[model samples]
Target chain A: MAEPRPAILIVEDEPEIRRFLRTAFGVEGYRVVESATGRRGSIDAGTHKPDLAIVDLALPDVDGIEVIRRIREWSPMPIIVLSARVQERSKIEALDAGANDYVTKPFGIGELLARVRAALRHAVRSPSGTSILRFGNTVVDLEKRTALRDEEEIRLTPIEFRLLAMLAKQLGMVVTHRHLLTVVWGPTHEKDTHYLRIYMKQLRDKLEIDPVRPRHLLTETGVGYRLVLDE
Target chain B: MVSIDKQRKPPAHPFSKIPAIFMGNLQRSWATVLRMNLKRHWVGYAWAVGAAAACTFVGLVMYPRFDLVNVAMVYLLAVVIIALRFSRGPAIAASVLFVAAFDFVFVPPRGTFTVDDIQYLLTFAIMLSVGLIISRLVKSVRRQAAAQAALEIEAETERIRSTLLASISHDLRTPLAVMAGASSSLAESGERLSAAERHALAKSVFDQAQEMSEHVAKVLQMTRLETGAIKVDRDWASLSEIVGAVLARLGERMAAHRVIVELPDDLPLVRVDATLIEQALGNLLENAAKHTPPATVVRVCAQRRGEEVIVTVQDYSAGLSDRDLERVFAKFHRGSVEGAGAGMGLGLAICRAIVRLHGGQTWAERVPGGGTAFRFTLPLEEAPSAPLELASN
Candidate 1:
C-alpha cells in the first residue's frame, strides 16, 4: 500500500502570499488546501481535516485566531501561524491557543519549511512519548534527569537539569519562558525568565558541542526556547 | 529669546523711516495698553466700591468706642486687603475710596464730609500714600508670580520639543547612514566581493530601509494618536490572539529572549480595537526587548481581575529607577540604559496613547524580583454574546 501525501491547509488573506505558499509547498511534495479568508479557512479546516494548518493572524473575513480556536476545539493537528513582523502579541496568542509554531512574513522559504518540518515531526513523534531524546552528540535521559555527551556523563546543577528536562519533554517544540519557569521554579516564579536563561546557558554549555552557537538548546529570541533534536 | 528680540526690533527696511509706519506702531502699542487698563480698571472699581461700603459700616459701628485715628486705620486695613487681592489698579482705587470714606463717615462732624482739624488732613495724606505704595508692591509680586508660571511652562515645552527632535534625528540618521554605507560599498566594489558578502551588504541596506520605514510609521501613528485622528474601533477580541500575533510578528528578534505567555484559557474576551491593542502590546514587547539584555526572559501575562484584563510584559533586566518609571511613557523620554540603540522613544508613548484611547490605563513598575514590568488594563465589560467577526466587509 502506498502512503498518502500529507495535507496542509494554508489560511492567508493575501493572494500573493497564498500563491507563494502554494508554490513553496508544491515544491516540497505536500498536498495543500488553500483558503483566502478566515471563514472559508475555518470551514475548509473542518471539512478537509488536513494533516496540518497554517493560519494568518490578520484575515479578511474571520480572524486567523478564531480559525485556530475553532479547529483547536476538536482537532489536535499541528498548527503553524503566519504573521507580519509587528504582530508579536497575536503570535503568542496563537501559540497559547494550541498553535504548534509560527513563521513571520517576509520569511525565507528555507526557514518556513524548517519550522513546518519541525512542527510536523513533533506532531508525529510526540505521541510515542519518547523517554530519551538525542541531539547531535548529546543524549538526554528524561527518566533519569541526566544528560550525556558521547556516552560521558555531563554535570548539571538542579536548576539546569530541570530546564533541560522541560526542554526535553517538548523536543523540537518551543517551550515558553512562563512554561519553563512555572514547571521548574513554580507558578509564582513565572516571570523569572532570567533564571531560565542562566540555566539554559549552563545546560547548553554542558550538552552542546559549542555553547556559543548552540544547535540543540536553540533560542526563539523574544518568543521562547526550543530544543532541536537534530540540527 | 534672541529671535524674539530681533522680531521686536523695527524692520530694517527703508519703509521703517516713513511717518505712517512709525505712527501705526505707536497707535498699536497705545491701544494694547489702553485695552489692558480698561479691563483691569473695571474689576478694580467693583472691588473699590465693595471695600468702601464695608469700611463705612465698620466706622459707624466703632465710632463711639474707637477714636477717629483708630477708625481711619480700619480703612487702611481695607486698602491693604484690596491691594493684596487685586493688582495695581484696584489697589489705587481702594486707597482713594478709603480716604474719602474715612472723611465722610468718622472724620470731624460725624457722618458728614467735613474735616475740622488740619491734623486729620495729615492722617488722610499719610494713609493714602502708604496704601498706594502697598498696591504697587502687591502688583509687582503678582506680576512676578504670573511671569514665573509662564516661564516654567515655556521651559518645559521647549525641553520636551528639543528632546523629541534630538531623538527623531538620531533614529532617522542611523538607518540612513547604514543604507548609505552599504549601498556605496556595493556600488564601488561590485566585482571584488564574494556573492555572500554582496548579499550581506544588500541585506543590510534592505534591513535599514525596513527599520526606517517602521520608525516613520511609528512616528506617524504617534502623531495621529496625539491629534486624535484614530478612532477606537471597539470589537470583541481574543486576548490570546493578540498575544500570539505580537509574538509571531516579533519572530527572529524575539528569539534572543524567552517569551513566556500566561494568558489563561478561561480569560474573557475584551472589547477593544484589535489593531490598536495589538500595536500597544507590540510596542511594550519591543521596549522590553530593546532595554533588556539579549537572552533574558520576557514574560507576557494576562489575567482577568474584576472587570478588566490586565496584560503585563515583564523583563528580567535592571529595573527602571523611580524617575524613569514616572517619565518612561513621556514623549521622547529615553531611559538611562546605555547603548540602548537609536530609538525615538515613541514606542512607550504610543503604547500609552493607544491604551488611553481605549479607555484603558498603561503603567510601568519595577517587579518585586529585580526587573521592569509594563502593564496595561483593558476594560473587560460588554463581551459580545457571540464572538465578534472583526474582519472588515
Candidate 2:
C-alpha cells in the first residue's frame, strides 16, 4: 500500500475558515481533520494524532491556547497557529506553548501552505543532520561555518556568522530574541536587543538579494527571526 | 448747655442696660437667623441640645470642687464643640443654651433665674457675646474648607477634560494628515507616477482611513464606558474561543510576531462580557505588536487559581520601566518606548475600563525574562456542567 498521506488537523471556530482551510489543505494531498470548537479540537487532536495541527487562537468552546497546551502535553507534532491580525499575544503564547509556526488570518493560501510545509518539514527532519543550508543562490556549510552566495565567498563578521548560524540552526523555525541574545551575547547582555537588530541588518545586506525587503532572512516583528530556505 | 440737654434726653431711660441702637441690631440679626432654613438644620439643632444637656450634667457634678466661673468655662467649651461639629444655626442655638445653662444652674441663687448682684449682668453679657463670636468663627472655617474642596475637584475635572481634548486632536490629526497627504500626492502626481507608485499611495490612504475608523471606535467606546452606558452582559464563555476570535480578527497585523497561547485544557468557564473582553485583549495584543520590535515573541497565558482566572499577555521587548508600568493604564498616557506607534494611548486605558467593568483587576509588570507582561483576572464562579459553545454565525 502507498504510504499514508500525513494527517493534518485544523481547529478553527468559523465555519467559513474551516471550509476554506479544508479545501486548501485537501488539494495539497494531506488528510485533514476539522474541529469547530477548542474542546472538539483537543479531542480530535488527541484521537487523530495528526502529523501537523493548525489552531485558531479564538474558539467558541475553548481557546486555541488550550488546544495547544493539550497537544503539547503528549505530542511533538508541529502546531501551526492561525490567528487574526491583532492577536500578537495569542500568537506568541501559542509559539511559546510549543506551537511550531503561525499564520495570521486573512492569510494568502500560498503563504499558509508555505508555513504548513515548513512546519511539517521541520517536524520530519532531524536538526542540522545535513551539514548544508541553502536559500536562493546562497549556500551555508554548517560543518565548516562558512557561507557562499552565487559561487562567491560571502565574508561574514563573527557576530553576523553567529546570528546567521543561529537562524540556520533552526532553518525555518522562529528563534526568539531572548534565545538569540543569550546565545550570541551571553545571558548578561540579553537586554541588548539592538545588537541583534544591527547584526541582522548586516547579515541581510550581505546575504539577501534585496536587503531592503529581505525574503530569506525574515524578521518577525516583536518576536525574533526566521530563516526561510526556498525549495 | 441747651444743645447738651437735647442730646442728654436719650440718657433719660437709665434703666435700659443695652443701648437702643444695639438692641435694634440684635433684633434684626435674630430675625434674619429665624428666616433661614431651620428645618434643614434640625439634626444639628438636636445635636446642640444634646451637647448642652450633657454639659449641664457635668457642671452639676463638678460644681462642688470647681468655682462658679470654672463651671461657666465648661459651658463655653460645650458651645465651642457644638459650633465646630454642627451648622451655623445649631451653633447659635448652642450658644444661647450655654448662656441659659450658666445663668440658671451655676450663678448664685443656683436653681433660680434671679441674680442678687447687678455686676453679674455684665458677666452674662460677656459670656453670651463670646459664644456668638465663636459660633461665627467656626461657621466661617467650615465654609472655607468646603470651598477649597470644591476648587480641587474642579481643577481635576478641567485637567482631565483638557488632556482628553489634546489627545483626541493629536490622535485624530495624525491619521487625517496621512490620509490627506497620500491622497493629495496621488491627485497631484498621477501623470508622473508609475502604476505601482499610484497603487502604493492609494493603499496608504486606505490604511490611514482604516486606522482613523479604529481610533474613532476606541474613542466612542471609551466615551460610552465613561458615561456608564455599557452594561456588563455576563455569560459563560470559553476563554480559548474568545482569544481565538480576537486572533482571527487581528490576523494579518500580527503576522510578524510569534504568538503563543498557553491556556489549560481544564480551565473552567469564566463569566464575562465576551465582546468587551475580546476588545480589551485585542487592544493589548495590538499594543504589544506595535511597541515591540519585529519577530519578538508575544505570549498569552492563563492560569486558574481558586476562583479567579488570571490571563497574561507577555512580550519580550525592552521591558517597560517602573514608571511606564504605573501610568500605562491612564487615558492618553503613552510609553516613551522608541519606535512605538502613534497611538492615542487609549488601548491600555480601555482595557482597564473593560476589565474593571467585568469586576476584574488589570495590571502591568516587567516580565522576569526581559519584557512587559499585562495581566488581568476574572472572577470565576462555577463552571457550567456542559462546555459553553460559541454562538454560531
Give the per-residue lDDT of model 2 (tens digit) for B49-151: 8888898999999989988778777877777777667766777788777777777887778788898778767766766676677778887988899999999
What TM value does chain B of candidate 2 have?
0.83
- Expressed as tens digits, the lDDT of each residue in A83-152 for candidate 1 is 8745346777788787878887656777788888887877777764456778688787766877788889
TM-score of each: 0.54, 0.56
Q: Once model 1 is optimally superposed onto the true structure by TM-score, how far is the C-alpha of residue A113 displaced, in angstroms?
A: 20
Over 4 Å off in model 2, which ranges? A1-231, B1-43, B64-66, B338-342, B387-393
Mind giving the per-residue lDDT tens digits that candidate 1 earns over B134-162?
87887788889999999999999899778
Cα miss at B296, model 2 (Å)?
Answer: 1.3
